[model samples]
Target: MPEALLLVLMAVLGAAVILVLGLVAFRAAGDRSALAPPMPAAYRDDATGAWRRGTLRFVDDRLALKGSGGLAAGPWMRGNLDLGIARPLAAAEAATLGRSNLIQVPATYGTSTFELALDEQHYTALRAWVEAVPPGWNSQVA
Candidate 1:
């Protein structure tokens, strides 16, 4: 009788532990889901130019590009271009004058990072502009 009671107690404790673990797991998943959805692969604008928006989450040696948008899900590239192309002339100026290339533009809501390459002529200009941009400038939407 004592042995049976011991076994029952052990079983009850095991079940309680399992239940607690399951609840913890569920809570963690819910928290992760609460984070904003990843950015989208491409965003089409009425103005012009190709744009790509996504998150660059770094984990150790690997980086994740999470695309956003509802209906159509996009691919996750190793190195995602979070920012789309700027307007033609704007892009040209950014490229010609800015040497570093306009990988990401400062925005109000979020930082706009790009994957496009720029010409050497724009290198100096691009570098200067990028350097001048205030930190957190990308957090603004406009």
Candidate 2:
């Protein structure tokens, strides 16, 4: 009985180690220089099809999300913003969603289409930062 219990514990510990390593690798996968500082936002969780709390940061032309929901919150992942051909929905149009702070951003990968909810104060800054990316820089796929 003791041996069986030990085996179960070992299995649980192994799983945790794997998860941590995965998160670390995911977080380190992208270009460090192009990474902008992270800001708090809510991202749609691809795994569970639910909205989860996370940090959103721009990694070059891509947006990466690092979830804070828990171990099961999933890995740090990035999606192409496809800014070359797409822009964030107009603020006025987005405001029609009934949440003034909601911003719908289109992407080509990861969570392809996601909504990010930001406070009124931070909304303007985020939108400006995204729009200011040089148009020429967005021509190439990230």
Candidate 3:
């Protein structure tokens, strides 16, 4: 009985050591991503004009959108498209007389338009990316 108990204890100890090492490696990977440049575009909108944070990454000429993340900052949705595939639009929906429109992307599911809440810096960055994207398939739904 004592010998069996010793074996079990050894197994548990080994598992714990492996878990700790994996966690350390995961943290290191996260740090490496931090070294990369910030996303070229991030925009948000709220009724009151308060800044809303969202992930709009441009890497290797691809766009990545991460909505509100989970507890560990995992993106709720992850999608990327070549810069050539994105079609810039003045407005996704018909503009009303006083409508304040925010940036909109025509995602696979349909047009996803953000609310009007992005700060000045983020808004400018978004415009730069949109204007730079080369014309592609007419994805911008009329």
How well is each residue in 41-124 modelled by candidate 2, as lDDT tens digits?
555523234456566666555555666643232232332233223234456644544444454442333445445555544555
C-alpha lDDT of residue 111 in model 2: 42
TM-score of each: 0.26, 0.42, 0.38
User: What lDDT does each candidate get?
Assistant: 0.41, 0.54, 0.43
What are the per-residue Cα lDDT tens digits for candidate 1 across 34-125?
A: 22333222222323455444343323222244445423222323232233334333565444433333433322113333342333333333
> What are the RMSD figures for all models against the true structure?
15.1, 8.2, 9.7
Decide which is better by TM-score, 1 or 3. Answer: 3
Per model, state how many residue pairs clash.
29, 0, 4
- How high is the lDDT of residue 133 in model 1? 45
Tens-place lDDT digits, model 3, residues 53-91 = 445544434444444551122221222221123333244
Better of 2 and 3 by lDDT: 2
**Candidate 2 ranges with C-alpha deviation above 4 Å:** 1-35, 45-49, 69-111, 137-142
Using TM-score, rank the candidates from best to worst. 2, 3, 1
- The TM-score, computed over Cα atoms with residue i paired to residue i, of candidate 3 is 0.38
